[model samples]
Target: MNILAIDTANNFLSLALHKDQSTHIICEDIGNKQSEFILPKINQLLTENDTKLQDLTSISYNAGPGGFTGLRIGLSVAMSLAYSLKIPLYPVNMFAMYHNALNTETNSIIALDAKLGQIYLAGFDNNGDYLIEPQLINPEQLSSVLSKHNLINDDDTIITGNGWTAYTEIFNQDISSQNIQYIESNYPSAATMINLVLSGKSQPCAAHEAELLYLRNKVALNLEEQKQSKQ
Candidate 1:
């Protein structure tokens, strides 16, 4: 079955198409420009691969804990495409995609930028079970938060996500894991969703049933809060 996947939960727009048992992936570091590039990139991906939009049997998207506007754009695009194409829709979690992509043996933590001096994090055990659900926390409070969850207290715990990528200096100073590791793969890709699809981990549903997975209620901050957050 041919499938198309989209991930615009962050600045980068990542698209993947699977056909003829081959997977094609495209990732563009277009910050805050997903709306402009998503459709064109999808077209380019399909055209370059000799595939048609109607040929896709299913579509998947990263239903975030990410950028508010990015999630809206990606979700709307995915749902519209799925609805029009009459194909099933798969709503994949951004963090779970990274977890699946890394396949790390030790406990792992996914921390993605939430802006306003906050981050979205999810903790998983070595067996891929959730130790902590996705939630927002300040980077400086990571130690306390992890300690409260008792999720990644071990010596070899792995933490990988764009949160670290975006604030490497902060994490290196605030987080004191001797071997704290952040993977080179900090961004999400539709290819990761394809991996989940192949493993039957990311389930599919009708377009009407697809929904965004938000971790918090505060989407935007007041001007004063924004100014303070930078401090």
Candidate 2:
């Protein structure tokens, strides 16, 4: 199956085409400009791989717990394409993609910067099951959120996401220095979304039936708010 995957859930635009048992990817940072670059980038990836939109059997996209505008742009594009193509649209979240990229072989807790003094946290099992569905928590409550959700029941759990970088002191209080594992958040892959779809880690639906996954109530970011999620 020729599958298309898109991830504009952050400052980056990542698109991948899974075809012929091979994967082709294009990822770049075009901060706050996803709407401007995503279509062309999708075309670029498909063109480079000798493929077309109609050739895709299904589409997968980063359905959020991420940047507000980015999620909307990604969903709008994926929805439009999938609707027009009459193909299935698979819904995957940024946390799942982030955890899957690591291939850590252990359950992982993902804590992304949610701005407004809150962290967007979620956890996934080794098999890509959600131990903690994405939620917003104050930085001070990071430890409690984990405990309350039974998220990090063991010390070996892999902790990821940009929240670790943004709120070091807060995370250090929860995840000890010795237990700290830094898996850079920039490594998110649209290819992983394709793999998740093919593996049935997420289900597919009609484009019209799909919706954006927004953990935070608001999406638009001011310059200072944007600074809150650096890296």
RMSD, every candidate, angstroms: 2.9, 4.3
Please provide TM-scores, in order, for all candidate models, with all chains considered together.
0.84, 0.87
- Which residue pairs collide in model 1, if any? none
Best by TM-score: 2
TM-score, predicted candidate 1 vs. hidden true structure: 0.84
Model 1 stretches with alpha carbons more than 4 Å out: 165-184, 221-231
The lDDT, on a scale of 0 to 1, for candidate 1 is 0.84
Query: Candidate 2, residues 41-71: lDDT per residue as tens digits?
Result: 8988889998988899999988987777788
Overall lDDT per candidate, in order of appearance: 0.84, 0.82
Which ten-residue region of model 1 has the weakest summed lDDT?
216-225
Clashing pairs in 2: none
